[model samples]
Target: MYICICNAVKESDIRDAVGAGVSCFKTLSKNLSLCTDCGSCGKKAKQAFHRALAESGASSNVVSIDAMSTAPVRRIQSTIKVSASATHHQKCIKTIL
Candidate 1:
């Protein structure tokens, strides 16, 4: 159900955004960064956005969040140390892949 695995975005999250007055894909993407990584989920995310928008019955007047204050933010650790990776919790995040 996670349309954007890189960002951990789910379809239900999109629906909730629509319900909360996100009337277009661009605004929603700005907040949640949908389809921003890898671009594999662009089609599916767009489809879900439209479907949710239609179901929400909200206006198509192009409402925006944060008024385009800044680019979407994603936090990343500066580096991963081997000792930290040995911990079970961090092991999953800093994995062999």
Candidate 2:
């Protein structure tokens, strides 16, 4: 779904950005020009950011995907492992919700 009409930003773009380690509104704004124009998409952007963070199994609310990509192999593996586990839990909760 489209999040920022002014910038042509979509929910998928936000998810990809989050997977790429954009964890904050500022970084999202800088990278995707999310809320820069009319600032109406800020709330949705934040929601998407948080949802992506939860899905990614990132411990920090302010993770940087660029940094994660550069991290050691073991760390990356662990992140993937955690993300898998979280995905299962999320599915269950989603079904319930």
Candidate 3:
């Protein structure tokens, strides 16, 4: 399913981004160039973002997708990496984001 027609961002890409710790639409837009043009895909992009978060088992309460959009990208990425590392239990996992 294509989430962003302007950027050609697919649902799977959004999910991968979520798995990599992207929790906000803004970060998604910055990283993937989604919803950056025309703004028609904002709603769909947000939906995809939330859906990805849910599927990834991440708590939406911890980081509001709407609020996190305004945060600095580096800060959000670092925080997400830290949290993911802390919660992930498996060994031999070398990378998360």
For TM-score, the strongest prediction is 3
How well does model 2 score by local distance difference test? Answer: 0.65
lDDT tens string, model 3, 18-50?
898765555677899976788888788878877
Please state every model's RMSD to the true fold in angstroms: 13.9, 12.2, 8.8
Q: Rate the local accuracy (lDDT) of all candidates.
A: 0.63, 0.65, 0.65
lDDT of 2 by residue, 1-97 (tens): 9989999999899889878865455557788987789999988887786787788876463323443356654453344335634454333333322
Model 1 scores a C-alpha lDDT of 0.63
By summed lDDT, the worst window of 10 consecutive residues in model 1 runs over 73-82
TM-scores of all models?
A: 0.59, 0.58, 0.60
Model 1, C-alpha of 67: deviation from truth (Å): 28
- TM-score, predicted candidate 2 vs. hidden true structure: 0.58
Give me the runs in candidate 2 sitting further than 4 Å from their true place: 61-97
For model 3, the local distance difference test gives 0.65
